[model samples]
Target: MAAALGVLRRSDEGQSLSGAVLLAAHDLLYEQVPFPLGESSLCRLAELLVGRGVVPKSSDYEGRWYLWWPKSGRGPCRDCGKSRSLTRFSGRFGDDYRYLCARCRATERHVIAERVEQLHAMPGVQAAHSAWVCGPGPTGTRSAGGTEAEIPSAQEWSEYATRLHEMLSPLEWAGFELPEEWDTDFDRRHGGLLFETLWRGDGGVGVSYHPHEGKVVLGPFDDVAGQWPHSYSLLEDSLEIPVPGSGRQAAAAVEVAAGQAGLLDATHVYVAESAPEEARQEFTTHRIRRIFQPAAEFRRLPLNELLRETTEDHWLSSYLDWVVGRAGQDVAPDIVPDAAALGVAAWCWRNNTAVEAHHLETDVLMARVNIAVTRLTRQYICPVEGIDWDSIKDALMDPGWALPDTTPIHSLFGEGWTEVAATVCAELDRWRRLDHERLGAQTTLILMTIGGSTGYTDSWWGQGRWHSICRHILDEAIAAGLTLPAPYDRNGPEAFLADLHTPDRLSDAALDWIIDLRGAAFEGPRGLRMNRITRPPRHCWDPFWHSSTGV
Candidate 1:
């Protein structure tokens, strides 16, 4: 009964009785009965099947692993297609395993090293340390190659002078000429005035009065490399700072001013360090009072009013308001409002709608709409305006516009309208009229010469407007005496049919005539003649035959 069962279960390929019984047991235990078989037992069954040729052995190093027929031999090695080989390897014991050939590995390493060297030699990174230490001075002080100077404080210098029994050392100062273009009024009103006094060790620092805090705060001086990095540290440590007004009164005034400026949600206001301690304390207290207020109740504006205020040259606030308004319009519908979605939509509309070259997907959609509008206006609507839509249609349908069958020109443009399509079409038409005169020029020769693989697939060509325009131009050229031989044809015919067409089997004489005519057109007019080739004139249009056959 066991032998009969094995025979009944045996595969069509003639496997042994034991192997057939094992496979049946495997299928019954794992799949039929739904009893879970452990990995070790599964592997053992796989080995038995592989030994019986019911499955394939993938590798000898590992125990017999089953290979299904469909998935086997599908992968090809990068180096050679003959045998399956490792394409990637993990590192073992700190040494990297390589699956690539020795030559390819060496080439890859050389490329990586060159890129690394280029990065290390970049100028910005090389000057980082020197630029950091020098601050905003005209020149950096030279020190020993590997050593740096210690930064000194103002009190330390004064104390040292007093211990030496010397009068205070004369203040050594460096003067920088401010450009006339610098706004003096903005400087005075904001805090640019405080930065004018160049303290001995102080690099670049600016000051601004905080109206809300009624205090003067130290800000940073703007240089080519931007604000001084150490200004924050100085602000925290400075003593005997100037105080201007009351912080509570200033904060109230700022709130009123912000409301007028449409900044009702303003949260944090900065106070100047030079402001009076009383005013600073009051401003801090007022901020604490508003700590539990809902964020939606107020708008947050940066505390530096002088910087935030709009001038004719600076319209940041107005622009921000416009952006916010647009965002509000887009998010009025969805159940769950997403700020990021609104921002992305706004960005796409602004960037894609206004600029020509900036036309991305949104711009393409807009252009398609524009083209449809233009066509509709010309056809159904332009007649009311006394424009001739019929004439335009007739021009498009003219015999002069008909293209060749062999030239697959329509496959170049994408499906939708491209912004550059009209311009490209006009250029192609101009070239078609000029022909030899235009294409003889170096620039035109470069444009017309088709040498390298375009790498564009048929699907890509089928979808674009530019592809269709290209097809139209090529077809038009063929109709207007520009004969391009079919790309697939080896032995040229006067009219080469596509491969899918049934051959008509022309008479010997007619076939000879076609071949001769095509050969002459290619070799004589195009200057692609081969030596020791002779042909009789088959047609008047055949330039080579005209010279050779003299018919």
Candidate 2:
């Protein structure tokens, strides 16, 4: 509990903990505390802490049981009427965040930029125009005076980011906005604001101000000098105030004030749609697509059809036939080989990973693979209890065996398991071509633990004598004249499998080659099932963590 609270308040302020977030923090720290049945179990637990004086309940929220949570937000914007996140309004605008919201600020900056663009090209005060204030302001700036001497503590700056939006946004947009995903830190750090009156002077002079850093820069906008370590300051005459007078004009107008604001290149706005999130999602989709080739026609291809059209590759043919026999009723176009076929495939997929010696800890790999498969396939096939022959057989015989709200795997046993187990073993046997002894040992273990039995898991994954599974798998592959690609184990199979149990020691580039060798991985199911996913889940694929758990 202490550790969880420490982590929650690590940003160094009384954190406004929501029921869900509070539970997550506590559960993460207390891994043994398996979540109770209700979604609000952890939330209700907060009442205990509050009642016992373990923590004080925040006045702002019933869920916020922190001793001293931060302020709500800048509040409803007097200008725009929307309570803006700090991304759009900063405390720098002063205690009340009086400055306009990001959009309103943009509208204002555009106003200034447009005015300058018009007057700089107009006759009379044909004086070149300048910007009054730009939204968010100059960003990604690397200038000097503004950053040379810092007045605030680094810890304090960190607090400012969280304090403003972490509190404000969550309190307002609770369900819609996630705390970690909020893009406020970059907004605060890369501040290069320009809030000077549009200069009516000629094009020779350019003005840039960084109020946050306490400095004003003056030079030609295109000066290659990289504004810094200034020898001159803002001159009284350099800054001339031009009033609203028709006659107040310069003798000659240079062209249009067409350049971007002195420092604002239009980057410092509050981009509600985060660039990192988009990029991460794109990369995930690409990685999944790399292995799971999209077959829009997959839904149309029935088990019977795919079963009928098989290659002499014997194993593919056997696997196809097994699918057809199990899910002949799944040919209804939308059902696509049916849910049982999916469940069987998932069970088989997990065993395939285990036989390949993917992870050091059997339970860890199995659970994660189960998660990945269920997510990828849209819960059509949930291999939640890990892999076993009985699970596969039930899925094969009963179309609705693993469908949503169906009987749990343990409770559903099948008489046809021996046949299914034998076929599964043979399919793995032909695909991997392991020796008789290696095949026999695994076949026995696989069958013995038919109906959700974990009896043999220790020998299968632990440091037992039989746990040379990684070594055995790799040894067989090498004997078959399958040497790794150049630059990996050029030293021979010994050096390659030397760190087999701890594959993470190998470099990432080496792991990519290893993954390619291990059938390029079927880490995810090809399609999503709406019954399975209602919200987004974070995915992180560690390139070198497994595929050895063979060594």
Candidate 3:
């Protein structure tokens, strides 16, 4: 009986056992094939197999009894056919061979399936998926960086002194010293601010408004090897100080950067004093706020958590809003939080969702392919494995579709899979295209390279009007030989090729304008896409993807 059940399990599509003497199971009993068992014996064996969970039972409505393996063990799912065994659950019928993968089982509920479909259909959802699958790459954000304000003239020295005085009280001026002759030269070391007073010796001091600390800082002249020894809290000066030479003091000095000053409180200052040999001084340190670093902020975006949600797009947008608000106002361009943090999160969420969608789509495509293969092979009495199903499946997943051995998969699986793979690939490509288009659409504050263009641009909006502005900005960034550091990178070249099928008159107009300006017409294919992008831009394009510079 177990032997018969094993044979039935290997059938894939399943086998039928009946009382009829001429049935296929009866032939095995006569030595016509293998497994010799009488007709009545086969029927009894089927009953025993069903009882032991070796084969799933068939409905009474069916003329013959159907036998299939138990669903509990690891193997391809009977429904979706996904070989990767994740959490499995039984179908409504029973806990037999008719089982589904977690996602497939979720579809048993019409509401859940509908919501999943709605989520897939949502604008920017597909884009997010593509971003996750590929990457958000190097989208820059507004961060706390050095300001490029015009160098203050000698006449402005008094005003600078007044601002500096606001940060320091007459009491803490004990060891603090100011230089007599203020250097008006723009120095990159002190946040591009001209020195109010220049210290002559090797241990010369400098001053700059700290963007992250929101206070004034006085540090060593050679910033690389030295420290900013002091940071002041202006709003409420219950004088917070750092122990003269502690690590925190050193950290405070380095964090002081040039940017628009923010409001500071008593908590912003830390002070400590080391006790001599006989006296052990208690180490008391005050922590006001974390010194902000864009790279550190990027690490904290919670991208993985966002990707786990069904509505990842909404969550990512909300998170970006929160980050922007937390960043606060009048932040110098250099010191603003990297605006690209939102895009990075969005990219991760989208990539994760896209992977899920890909697997789901693969199951559906493979099911159809399997059905066709089953019908054709059964008619021709051929081996199923002979059909190159793996090749077809791989092609469906590969974006490039450049299988090393391009020997037609159609020959092995028949022409049916060719259409199926093509259809699935086309659908997947749509999401990929959305992801590319959504890139520069997300944030305007940072310079980015939009679409398939080779140059970097400054335009924040995706509209045709803004594209021209972006093109000009790209030229400017290039002309200035600007290269960003760390979290920020120059908007380098991309594999973007504009979707020629875009329905927007503005997009078309913008293309036409480019052709006229450059005196070069784009005579390539219509509705053509290069690289990962697949379709035309949608009519209702959000210039900044869905992010606002509000925060």
lDDT tens digits by residue: candidate 1, 128-152:
4221211111222222132343332
Off by over 4 Å in 3: 1-335, 338-341, 348-350, 354-508, 511-551
Those runs of model 2 whose alpha carbons end farther than 4 Å from true positions after fitting are 1-58, 61-64, 67-418, 421-551
Candidate 2: C-alpha RMSD after superposition = 26.8
Q: Estimate each model's TM-score.
A: 0.14, 0.18, 0.17
Give me the candidate number with maximum TM-score.
2
Best by lDDT: 2
Question: What is candidate 2's lDDT per residue for 1-551, written digit by digit as tens?
Answer: 55565644542375555545564565554354443422243444443233222232223233332312222223343456665422223332123223344355445444544543354456743321111111112231222223332333443343333222221221111111213212222224434333222221111234343323323333432323523211111122332222121111210010001111211100011112333454435433442232122121233354334324334446444433443223221111111111222333344544533323333233333333343333333323211111233434334434444422343322222444444445555543443332132222222222211211122121121111111334444554565556564454577666665554344335544443343343322542111111111111111222221132221
The residue-by-residue lDDT of candidate 3 on 1-551, one tens digit each, is 44544555554344443333223343354344232334445554444333332333344213133322222233454556665332223222122324444345435433432433354357876343211111111231112232333333443443333323323322111112333223443433332232442221112334553211223344433333224222221221122222111122222322321111111100111122222222111111111012112222323444334224313556434533343223221111111111122122122222333332433233323222322322222221111111122333344444443212343324433434455455544433433333233311112212111111111111111212232233333343335453322122332422012221121212333333222322222542111112111111111111121123321
Per-residue error (Å), model 3, residue 314: 22
